[model samples]
Target: MTDQKSKDPLHGITLEMILTQLVERYGWGEMGRIIRIRCFNNDASIKSSLQFLRRTPWARNKVEALYLWYKRETAG
Candidate 1:
């Protein structure tokens, strides 16, 4: 079989990378507005967001959803 991780989208992708890209594209103040999660709204940073997102699946899904939206919006 091929490299096992090659088929996985989230594999090797750290939550910090996700949050950094999203923050770079939109900034934390606005990202919080978009994602509406306390981690993004409170004293947020890559560390805090990663902690929250890793433990909370629903919030992580929302963050991923926004990342998808950002990808689509910027791709065009």
Candidate 2:
């Protein structure tokens, strides 16, 4: 068997890592504006945000997309 996840950029990355980086770069207030989830809108913690994101696919997709964009923006 082969690892199929090697082709994915986010394969090895954890949701907590993604949220941490976004929060570090943009902060909770900005993340709320960008994502508008209750987790990001209220007392946003990695545990809370991860729970919400795991249950909500749409919101999770938005977060992943934003993380990718953030990575590109900061790459330069």
Candidate 3:
């Protein structure tokens, strides 16, 4: 095996890390605009967002996608 997780971009990344970075880069206002989730809209916190994202696959996917895009954008 060639380290299966190596092929995954989110392999070693935690949900909290992703949420933190996204908030740092975009802030709640923009993040809400991008994902349209209530968690990011009203009273947003790492804890609330994490709890919501954990239960919501679609929203989590959007968050992950944004995180990946953010990483690529800032890389260059």
Candidate 4:
């Protein structure tokens, strides 16, 4: 038998982790500009952003996509 590794880039990563990384790299202002969601645009915090993303699929998708892009950009 052979063992195989997951190819997913976001495997084992949580929503909170993605949000934290984006905020750390871009800050709330840039995230708001990039994503245009109320949670990120108004009084943003990791907790609040997590709540919003958990409930809103579209918004969450945007955030996740941005995170993937961010990771690729900074992977060097």
Task: Return the top candidate by lDDT.
Answer: 3
What's the lDDT for all of these models?
0.83, 0.91, 0.94, 0.91
lDDT: worst 10-residue window of model 2 = 2-11
Q: Better model by TM-score, 2 or 4?
A: 4
Task: Write the residue-wise lDDT of candidate 2 on 1-76 in tens digits.
Answer: 9856587879889988998999999999999998888889888888999998999999999999999999988888
Output the better candidate (2/3) by lDDT.
3
What is the number of backbone collisions in each predicted candidate, taken in the order shown? Answer: 0, 0, 0, 0
Put down candidate 1 lDDT per residue, 1-76, tens digits, no spaces: 7755576556687777888999998888998888788877789889888888999999999888887677788889
Candidate 2 C-alpha error for residue 16, in Å: 0.8
The TM-score of predicted model 3 comes to 0.92
Q: Which prediction has more favorable lDDT, 1 or 3? A: 3
Worst 10 residues of 4 by lDDT: 67-76
lDDT of 4 by residue, 1-76 (tens): 9988989888999999999989998999999998899888889899998998999999999999999998888887
Give residue 65's error in model 1 in angstroms: 0.9
Candidates ranked by TM-score, best first? 3, 4, 2, 1
- What would the per-residue lDDT of candidate 3 be over residues 6-73, giving only the tens digit for each residue? 77899889999999989998999999999999989999999999999999999999999999999999
